[model samples]
Target: MAEVEIVVAHRERATLRVGEVFLKVDADRARADAEVEAMALAPVPTPRVLWRAPPVLALAALPGTALDSTASPAAWAAAGAAARALHDAPPPPWPGPSPEEIAARLDRECAWFAADDVLPADLLTRNRRLADTALRPWTPVFTHGDLQASHVFADGDAITGVLDWSEAAPGDALSDLATLTLGREERLADVLAGYDADVDTGLIHAWWSLRCLLVVRWLVEHGFDPRPEIAVLEARR
Candidate 1:
């Protein structure tokens, strides 16, 4: 029998890896549906779907390890190339958050942070001002939506595949760039080099600030320290 390992679990979802198969169980069926559809639509390498049942999805494990801990600039470039391929594909049928929606979320989350005193008021203010740059109109592209390092798999300088399509949708390409380079700002140039189009540096920086600020509180609530993200935010100031 294949050994079953608990990958991750939370109130909303859980993942179990049984040898070469990964089983994802999501409480929200819509998210599971999106994952299935997004994997089918994406042009880049995605984990092969083996089977699915409501609230659960089974995927064949990709060969490489997660890219989060890799320090190679070449690997970063490969990840960027994969991102470019995905963006170059036809847009998913579903929509992503519009600029206005993102701005609104920032506003709401900032208010919560202020009420909770999560960070120094001045730090939050500075970051919020910087975030304004990312709030403008953008040409939408197919986006990974959650392009965390853990979701990308690389073998040496080559990208094997990207995982977790649950948040996949149409959104600003910079969002994916920013997400991939989060806390690892030094690799931004390498990633951009592999990208298909000219990137707006200001928007990427703004998204970084916005993203870090928005997620800090959530990280803390989940018993994860937000210090690293906070350090990233402060460094930008």
Candidate 2:
């Protein structure tokens, strides 16, 4: 058989054109893709899952660039609206990992830190405190666990599609907003305004700070230099 032609290569996955089929593959990508396809709802154009083989899933090729590279404010608004629409979609009866399971995973990651690093400790504590206070009263909404621009695609002022549903879960919507914002505060403001979101900006900022700290600590533990960008973001706090 002739080898498939590679179209795009992303971090741990690749998009390939295999004869008449477009294949998107990475371990565990199928589960999320399957879930998204099975859930009946609005007109969101999630990739059509053709086949599943554990870590490898094949999806129809979506045509567009990742929203991260798109500069149009209208495109950003469309992305925000798409996220809101996905959140409003009724979820399937799939059993997601529980809070205890997530905490255990975090605990495993936290174990990588040594006494010299205080950021992880502070992050864990802050997450707990926020869970009790701010997040407690908020209604849980379906969240794109890793709602970053890299996972979205846009065409001019319209969102062409969204990708990477692996981290899809039920959580506070503001967390997703914070993740999307990351280092783009102005864009974040624009997105919030465009979406007419009622989330507390202060809390989102707090979470953004904590999330950055978590990244810094992870880099430190992995023997990477936590300099420059991390230092700058930390200085802003």
Candidate that would win on lDDT: 1
User: What range of 10 consecutive residues in model 2 has the weakest lDDT sum?
Assistant: 128-137
lDDT of 2 by residue, 42-138 (tens): 3466666777665666666566777663468877777778777766766534544454554465454445433455444655455434433323344
**On residues 1-237, what C-alpha lDDT tens digit does candidate 1 reach at each position?**
889899877677889999999999998988898888998888888899898887888999998788864558888888889999998888899888898888888998899879988778998898999998888888788999989988999888888888998889889888899999998888899889888578888889999998987788778777678898888888876
CA RMSD of all predictions:
1.5, 4.9
TM per model?
A: 0.94, 0.70
Off by over 4 Å in 1: 69-71
Cα deviation of 56, candidate 1, in Å: 1.3
- Model 2 residue pairs with clashes: 27-55
lDDT of 2: 0.61
